[model samples]
Target: MPKNRYRNKEVKFFVTGHEMEMIDKKAAIAELDRSKYLRKMALEGYIIKQDFSQVEQLVYEVNKIGNNINQVARRANEVEYVSLDDIKYLKKQLEGIYGQIEKFYDGG
Candidate 1:
């Protein structure tokens, strides 16, 4: 709250209940009063960002798992599976690991 910034105009907008709850949680984690945090973000274009180093690590681990699967499958264009059940099981396991890399990749 800087007085030199000039007068503060109040503005209101509709938000979903879930969004409101998330705002409250974020403000609590930052130890900021809800209104103050909201106002600061609104006026300053500031946002709270999550630390994604752990997420990057998770992505790395998942990618290793996918590579291991590919290697075990002989790195072929087609997968060799004797049974539908086995393919289904493998797909389920890999689904959880998919897109995790994209989440943490900054596209550098």
Candidate 2:
């Protein structure tokens, strides 16, 4: 911890056990001690809360698409057969993922 150059004020608050646990978790993720984390959050006037469910779902879909492509490739290698429909479907899926990512970044 660095010495506070202008230590002239103090702030205090009370929180329940659950709230404290949440604070600890957030602070840990932010790589800051609890007091510093709270001070930065208080002064910054904004906090970013991420919902990763959509991202996780997107990753899952991408993985599935990749697996399908792999299977298609293996089949193509075994026999000289490749489906244009599957390639088109993969393109559409990728486009959908791109749109979803754009929406997410746009605060949808």
Candidate 3:
């Protein structure tokens, strides 16, 4: 009654206690379970792990900038005037964003 069963074969193996501990550590780092980690290692012989916390923070900063810009635009529309200080503030925010992007790409 199964629609798809691509992985129908099972391979069983055994390892020592220290080897299991190392496998558990690596699986934790990769955010995968032991079975998936073993399958990936067996199939590809390697695993690539990446941290995106900085990128997530960058996205949060960009969202805050967008909100600030929207507020400035709304205020300008209401008063029909944009001040020099507002322009300077927006320019500074943009520069900060650019600096973050640069740092991210440069691996800093």
**Candidate that would win on TM-score:** 3
Q: In angstroms, give how far residue 22 of model 2 lies from its true place.
A: 19
- Model 2 lDDT, residue 1, Cα: 32
Which portions of model 3 miss their true places by more than 4 Å? 1-44
- Using lDDT as the measure, name the better of candidate 1 and candidate 2: 2
Instruction: Report the C-alpha lDDT of model 2 over 1-108, residue by residue, as the tens digit.
Output: 346657657788999999999999999999999999999999885867988988887788788878978988898898989889978887888888788888878877
- Which of the predicted structures, 2 or 3, would earn the higher TM-score when compared with the native? 3
Local accuracy of candidate 3 as per-residue lDDT tens digits, 1-108: 354868878798899999999999999999999999999999989667998999999999999999999999999999999899999999999999999999999998
Q: Give lDDT per model, in order.
A: 0.71, 0.86, 0.93
* TM-score to true structure, per model: 0.37, 0.54, 0.62
Taking the tens digit of each residue's C-alpha lDDT, what string does model 1 give over 1-108?
576666566578988999999999989998999888888778776667878776777867777777766665773446544456656766776775655555546542
Ranking by TM-score: 3, 2, 1
True-vs-predicted CA distance for residue 64, candidate 3, Å:
0.7
Which ten residues in a row are the worst by lDDT in model 3?
A: 1-10
Clashes of each: 0, 0, 0
Please state the error at residue 48 of candidate 2 in Å.
Answer: 3.2
lDDT of 2 at 103: 81
